[model samples]
Target: MPDSGGLQSVEASQRPDSQVRVFALPPRDNAAATTIVDGFLEALTSDDPSYAVARKYLTPKAAKDWHPERQTLVLEDGPRPHSTDRANAEETGRNFELTGTQVARLDDEQAFQPDDRRYKGDLHLSLVATGKGKPKQWRIDTPPHGVVLGKTDFQRIYQSVNKYYYAVDSAAGSGAAGAQKRLVADPVFVRKWADPLTETVKEVLAGPTRWLNRVVTTSFPLKAALRDGTRSLAPDDANKLTVPLNKSADSIGAAQCRKMAAQLLYSLRDLSSSSVDEVELERADGRLMCTLKEGAADALVAPRYSEGTEYQYFLDAKSRVVRMPASGGAHPSPEPVAGPMGEGERRMRSLAISRDQERAASVSGDGRALFVASMVTNASLGDAIAHSGAKAEKDGFTTPSWDGQGDVWVADRDPKNRRLLVFGQGQADRMQEVRVDELSDDARIEAVKMSADGARIALLVTENGRTRLEIGRVERDHGVTDGDVEISVADLRRAAPEMEEVTAVSWAGGSRLVVVGRESGGLQQIRYVQCDGSTPTGQALPGLTRVSEIAASDTDLPLLAHSDDGIVRLPAGAAWQAVVKVGTAPVYPG
Candidate 1:
């Protein structure tokens, strides 16, 4: 069998203060010389009790030469004293031992023995005197098994012991025999203790563990470098790639890894900030249409006449600019009339055309009839029989008036009776009167307006130095029906107690109504009221103060209002843009 034993020599020298030291050294070519010196010193310093006797072989003077190296072990010799019993016996001449016998005894003590326990002790190193200088050498006899003769014998013996203790084969075998045999005398042992007995097994188990450890250690440092400072973990080049690893594992390097990570992070941020909804507006013929703009649903048209201009006829049943052919002009016409005047002519002649421009004018749904009123003429009606032809009538005494559908409602005063008049095509002679008995003797009707449907009417009546709103239902052919239809008497007191007189009243879409009143301060407030008899809702129209006239829409929402200033549209829902300032009073429904 080949030798499996290995020898490691450690050279060390003592310090000036005398301390024993030890260190390892590289191997020498001569295996026996290396083993003898290494093994001898190792046994001398070992914790075994047998090493005590082994130390005596070294000479005190010779040991002084052993000095420790800067990075190696050192050995030193100490004083040796004779036994007291032996010294005393020699002085007493007891003749216990002769000089020759003592020499023989010392030689026998140094003899090699296979079984004698004394000679089979541990080895030690000491300096011995040679020809010129002291040489370092080891004093060793043999183990109880006897000294091995050659390299083969030494390996066999060592292998036998190694196989017995660590279960490894000698250096003579194949497979890991060479490596395993070298480890027999190595200072440290390396072995896998558990299930992963192979190198591949150990690597697999360690991969994730090593990776996790590297991540934990580097994560915080990498974040700090990138965030708080200008340092970057990635390379300057956009195409550069790098893999992250720690000291414990093999170096990792991959291309484009950092670039890919950055892209992924940016994508996540963009996704988080995205929004998902839709929005729109409604328009018609380049005009934005809204229900709240005009008081009515349809767009508003301007009144036909300008301020201070007097018109001859009222709106006909169709709301066109037409006149009443039956009533003749009160003033002598330039053209002579062929017909003779009757007794009724004198009564109707009192209804002269007022010099003041018609303060109020409204057309019927079909655009054939126009209702006109003024403080001077009291009332002058017109009808538009054709596009150009018009007829005027001076028939009754009325003030602020309105036309709805084919019927006309007006605020009028008679010498015998003061009331509201409802007139229509053939029923002009049969006009019905609405008497407000609740008003005081001094109170009088200032303005009146009929709803779009002709089913409701609003009256602005002044009573007892205060103006009050009287909303009532309209009876067929008859004037406004009476009821507890008063929308607001208290609001009238608060807004305008002295001049609580109503200036203008106009119907909005449906049962909604707007009543304009003048305050003592000359300020005007337009009160919005619901004819359905709910709480009277009011809003002040600042621009429409002292409103001398009013009108309503027939088809869409009612927004048309006429005043002394001009024809204006008070759109519904309080929209400012819905107000269309017209050049003339609007022809309703047309």
Candidate 2:
């Protein structure tokens, strides 16, 4: 076939039970330098478990020194091979420069570090003579360290997995052993088709990454590791997994041992086919220590809500708080909540329910006063816990969000008195002013949403008249007693970097957010973005118009949004259906 404007296509097919595999071809006889360089790059992105085929393209010394696991550089569009000026028809050795726009780097810890810079690396290939009548062959003598892959190829070759760790209760006295037993997810990338079982387990023993280490604690004992030279981990025919620890963990108690097993079970939950049903731990002497079954482990570390969300609340046309069963039928009847805000004594512009669903916080229609009241009883609206002096409603307090720790967070958008405030768990009398560590001088928060685990927070930050979404780590320092607790938001990173403007955002699931925004000069669209700023392919949902606010639960339930046509709900694999004729600010318990 003739060349057609440098365009080409390849068709792939496979059975439903099988997966698609990519292979790398070995170097051919009398191959040119370009072929050797290109073939080695292709092999780095293939399914070779140990990259054995890629090593065949290099010299013996280069092959022995190359380490593919050291790092992975991801480029915008795979590397481009350019023949250097040093290469000509006369030289036996040739040099080539691989160039591209580097987008990110996957370090040895399997953590993806985002980057944007130009990349240039040198590869030298030499021709070697054959012993017999065969022609000489070109081989890579000096190759770049580790591997380099394109964005698309990296996504295809690697997968995202979350390793569970217990959240550190800074409000409690001290030490992780006494902290709350809440599970926090630490995400990392591993090979999709490679020995993921062993790879993921190894990451667990290595402990959490630096960014998340301050807020989480792992069950793995110090210096605890897999037994000497142990590999090829897999469940037996009866769906039982046995893990043997090194000598450092031989003296651990039964309770700590079970916690270790629970961490392993949660880390491997995303594996295909749910192959593991039970986990057994063994000491260095091969003696059984503790065992945990799938059903039993659920009691120890379960989802956000064991029983599920009780109700979803929103504001009716009268600006009164109303509620319906969260898991109700397509159109469940909406009734006012049992509180003064629901009784129409005070009209609220927006509201947030605590994680326990026992208390509610409502902002007045003018957004100047924020009241906290009991949801279980018909209690009168209490005195304002927070007040914004800004006269304009748009410049007053934003919606409040509650974390699992019972703390309420809200931002005062008044340009003159901009501040982020937090109301402590039991201290309603004291409204603590929070200082965001790295926030810019001109930036102001438009909205705030906290994760259920109380480890991370999402903020719609506006700077220079453009609003963007950012994720920050919640750090708490309780000096000696609960009254001396200090909180600060640190390490802010863009969650949706490509969006030019973000209007509404919500935590859709663990480490995922449903964001409503638009690109530069583009129409508004709804998309799902990962906490690390990587947008998964095909994650965009059906388009909806005039979406003022959006809400999603941690569990995989229907998505509710307040759009121009009133409240709309999107069930799995279904279009946006009408939830009510008129409503606004639909939300589930955080």
Candidate 3:
């Protein structure tokens, strides 16, 4: 990941650490072979394409054979002391012992997979006499075969950024089976200070990363790239950019040209201090082909969560929907939502609201039934839609989650039907079941939240006595299922491998997530993690005494967690406050 000066919505004063260390220079010592091993490992993670700094500690032959890209082992914590054995000059130099808690690995192909376990290894090196008359110098005779980093360093150094790509268009021109072209986020990792505009286009032209290959597309032609000799695409006078395309992008139509602009505009919108409001494409000779405005692109590629008037919604002591000032004002008297679910005996175990906040979904106290209603205060609880068709023994449901497209998802915890189901716009009859058997035969989803942008779903699935966070990409096709448009979820992969037990999760930003979990031998914590399962090295939600349930939205403020102490919120730069002392399960509009 390049250190392009990119933007983040999360403010710094709220986090304990603002940056993480990615690589370090070798700490040289002639007598300590362990120091040589530590320096060698750090150099492998460095951005040097040729692995030069690391080579200073390695023999030329060893450097030539070692491939840093072969694998990246993510260890549990920061550096630790390695035991070294004294050497006798005649035999092998000595052996330095290394140990770690490895939570994940990225193989040679850059494919990331979870490997939650402990590792112990030895580095055999020599403290050899250069010549009979010279003092002996310690040098590494063997180095680890792959890159390895402790989890803390991994989070601090790498941040995930999403670049835009054309939607998997299921429908084409003139009513082709109810299809439309939209934008989907293609997440990539870059260092904390990457140049957003230049790096983004370069990455897009470089094509999708290994994880999302073929699942997305860009309008740029084959072998197309950001033309050379261009210093920057940022406009000096206004919020518009004119980007020069490589010669391969010479042949494109008007629609394709606009699509290209949409890709750029959306990709650049997440910059922390971006002024770019429009994007235009041009031939290498500087002929303008098409232009797109910020407003136009936003309408086409909806936000992960709608940025509406910020309101803090939660379930009061009486299990009713209520709201308070999001940024903390004179506390408004907590009031029930505009519907029957907010009153009556419809006690909610948990609640989820739509991005627009015009509708909501709730589960019963016993978790046996799911309900949905309009946001209007007068909507009757009796009139709320109910999902049918669950097997009698499998009637339990988890908290419902709403997506940008107005779909609500919930899991049926019934052992017989251990499946995830989606309800389109709260229509019970259109319920569609999603198969996730690959997660495990006994895996049952406990909690789930759909991303605001409709890209991924964060789920807490318990299998084989352990619960972990998995990010599931929603799969759709032209085919219909159970009277609803076809939608299934697969590609479930571990994110936050260090947390073996996850209780809750929510989208904190487009490419990031907030989760409630505990690391090995650690207390329960609320931490920020990337959607791809990567996390930034930072403090957990500050000033909260305890949290049982947490709520977050890109639509509203920072974070809210339901605790025994009360419903507390961590407003940026402020201590957690019991915002609404009466609410139990809390949530923001998705």
Candidate 4:
């Protein structure tokens, strides 16, 4: 694919050792039809700019007509070639059936669209005459429109990356200074060794992926693009990256330009082995638009998951809300929060702490009532803010969750009255039943975890005895009065379709979640799944038995869970160790 950075052709032998490189060889002299097809397929997976080497194995007409970037077909297994007529050895042409199980497709926009179907395509090859009595060579004249790759090769060639954009002011309430400064992460896969910095920048400029486009806004202008003919982007000796934009951005103001740089700064935060401490935006004519240092960028754009949490809260044996230091040592002492919810007669089932850590919401032990209390003051549990009519606790409310806007969300599991409820900011008494537009009538929500940016929500939905993880976008149509507000979760799509059952899920990062689930006929396991439904290869955590609840933070805090061995935690590069022997519901401030 041609990145806006303008990819340039390079020979395989001349590639340096900076990044993992895939090199493919051209067909051997006078290769057979099958050999030619195999070589062509292998070459498609290599890192050749414009796929020059792969095109050489095709007939002249096919070379001119093929467009590798039009699409990408990812298969469960690599494409298998079956000779259509192996018995006809003397024939001047050959046809092969290429078949595999198609798992997903990448469109021209580079967004992954999940699919499941049997894929069957054709490959046609024929003997092409060489000039002046030279031996004839076999060449492919017909191939699939897009390149085909196995799951393994797809993972090998591409990597998951997050591009940042600002959450709408309406979603995350504006502050006195300005719009709430939270940035949402839009995750996509890009070629790992193909000048990723440039590719990522182009993607950010292109805008958010389809699911996130409506909820997030980019600072770059619609017509903004990399300076013409720019190839690769690398930091200088002092870890500074200079991005030259097209004429479209020539009139951008200093403040807006800094916001653009902030987006780029965090979007490229994980560039492998490179420390980009500073970002400088330059106009097409090389005039500086603005410069943003790492520290200054933080002031412009508050990263969704950059803030460290102080405490991890949960319910103790007494069904009271208690907390321990989020970075508490292995045996950190637990204490009741300073609120009636912790000391009052009313016990709790599940709870959520607001992102700001100022308020707490908890569901009554029977899951019938949801109460809001202040964690900063010793206030009463007060009257329940919401209720579920289900007689049985199991059929009542799932856990309550708080979005970044200080709004609360919970689901009533009562079969006859199943629905999601939202308590809007500054309007707790005006509870609204949020519509789940795409969910099937028979499916019911079992759990929910809202993203800190207040734009998306992770749901554990149950249907026919199986639970699955899905991500839904939170949409609100505001009215002049609080009673006129309409809330709904649109575009509910699976975030982990491979797992047969998802029991618990928590937001682990800006665009990632920690899930407790399992595949069909497999044991329960803890793993990380992207919000876009793509799983990062080799990211399953070490085994833990009977895991029922899981928690994670955007920062470096350890992952905590309620398991058979009681509450346990997994620190970076360490095994799961005991946290508390009696805790039940583990949670970190949202």
| Model 3 stretches astray by more than 4 angstroms | 1-42, 45-101, 105-157, 166-183, 192-197, 213-217, 228-243, 269-280, 284-287, 291-296, 328-330, 383-395, 480-485
Every model's Cα RMSD, please? 50.7, 4.0, 7.5, 7.1
Displacement of residue 143 (Cα, Å) in model 3 is 7.7
lDDT per residue as tens, model 4, 1-590: 66478667977753234345789899889787888888988997788757889998988899899988888999998799988876846668889999999988777767776777999999988888756888778898897898898877787787888888988666433634644478898887788767788898888888888787777788899888999988878889999999999999998999789889999999999656458999999999999999999999887776454275788888888877788887766677779888786774687878888887778888888889888888756576678887789988899888888887778888999988899988875246768888998898899999989998888999999899999998998776768864365778899878887899999999988888999989999999888988887888767689999999999988778898999998888878879888778877888876
Q: What is candidate 1's CA lDDT for residue 152?
A: 19
> Tens digits of per-residue lDDT for model 2 on 318-398?
887888776667777889888686786877888888888888887888999888888766587768887799989999899
How far off is residue 498 in model 2, in Å? 2.4
Off by over 4 Å in 4: 1-20, 86-92, 129-136, 171-177, 303-306, 479-485
TM-score, each model?
A: 0.28, 0.92, 0.76, 0.92
lDDT of each: 0.29, 0.83, 0.69, 0.83
Candidate with more favorable, higher TM-score: 2 or 3: 2
**Whole-model lDDT, model 3:** 0.69
Task: State the weakest 10-residue window (summed lDDT) of model 4.
Answer: 171-180
lDDT of 3 at 575: 72
What C-alpha lDDT, on a 0 to 100 scale, does residue 74 get in candidate 1? 14
